[model samples]
Target: MQHGIHPAYRPVVFRDRVGGLTFLTRSTATADRTVEWADGTTRPVVDVEVSSASHPFYTGNARVLDTAGRVERYHRRYGRGDGAGH
Candidate 1:
């Protein structure tokens, strides 16, 4: 609400580097790259590592931990041998 003391607000693109996924979004972030969108307009493009498209939780490819095996191995190595549960 002041004078010309604020940064430029424009349209920018955030591209996921891992998944090669890109989306159009407005932000104050600057980009050294540009791309043509579906509207035939050139916009700033930014590269990202990972997004929901490639993330395990979002893609439903969640990885499971081998906790049971680790627990059994630990008990056999350092846990009590009386089988009384430590």
Candidate 2:
């Protein structure tokens, strides 16, 4: 609990342009841009590339990795190493 040593934590807007979503939250992060929130107050707006709205994992659009195929391709490109340690 020190005075004048902590960054100001205030209501900020995190915008996800790709998903066209905006949310207001409290954070220490600030931005030069501003946006009018649903409450009719203008808060510092920060543009984020990935959010739950646009993230594949969160949206249930994530692609399943084919590890077996990758291993086969790798073995094809470079012969599988011998049992002997190299």
Candidate 3:
């Protein structure tokens, strides 16, 4: 609760790179530019590559990689006999 040393914390706009959608939230982070928000006021704007609303994992595009299959394939190709049919 110090007076003049703390950075300002207020609602700022965060724009999603893919959708160009902007949302306002409070943080002490600074932005290189400012933007007019949906509420008719201008605030500092930060361009973000991903957010929970825009990330592929949260949106269900997460890939389940088959590491076990890759390891088995590698061993089958390089390991000694008791050979697996090609």
Candidate 4:
């Protein structure tokens, strides 16, 4: 609640390069780059490598890891022995 102690919050554009998506929001982050938004105004633009649009989890393209196979491989290599304080 103190004045002049907080970063300036303003409208900024987050651009996802991989997904080719852009979103306008308010944040304290700033960028030297600027881009024209859909509202016919120029705003500070920040380029991101990945966002919800391109992320595997958000896009439903995530690959399930084969943990069972990994466990089998580990047992085969180390031998499945009863943990009798060994």
- When superposed on Cα atoms, how far off is each prediction in RMSD? 3.0, 3.0, 4.1, 2.2
lDDT of candidate 1 over 12-80, digit per residue (tens)? 988888777789888889888799988999999888888987888988899989999988998889875
| Candidate 1 off by > 4 Å | 81-86
What is the per-residue lDDT of model 3 for residues 3-42, given as tens digits with 9 covering 90 to 100? 9999999888888988667788899989889988777898
What is the Å distance of residue 43 in model 3 from its true position? 1.6
Q: In candidate 3, which residue ranges exceed 4 Å CA deviation?
A: 78-86
Residue pairs in candidate 3 whose N, alpha carbon or C atoms collide under 3 angstroms: none
Which candidate number has the best lDDT? 4
Better of 1 and 3 by lDDT: 1
Query: Which scores better on lDDT, 3 or 4?
Result: 4
lDDT, residue 25, candidate 1: 82
Cα RMSD of predicted structure 3: 4.1
Q: If scored against the real structure, what TM-score would every candidate get?
A: 0.77, 0.76, 0.74, 0.84
Q: Number of the top candidate by TM-score?
A: 4
Worst 10 residues of 1 by lDDT: 77-86
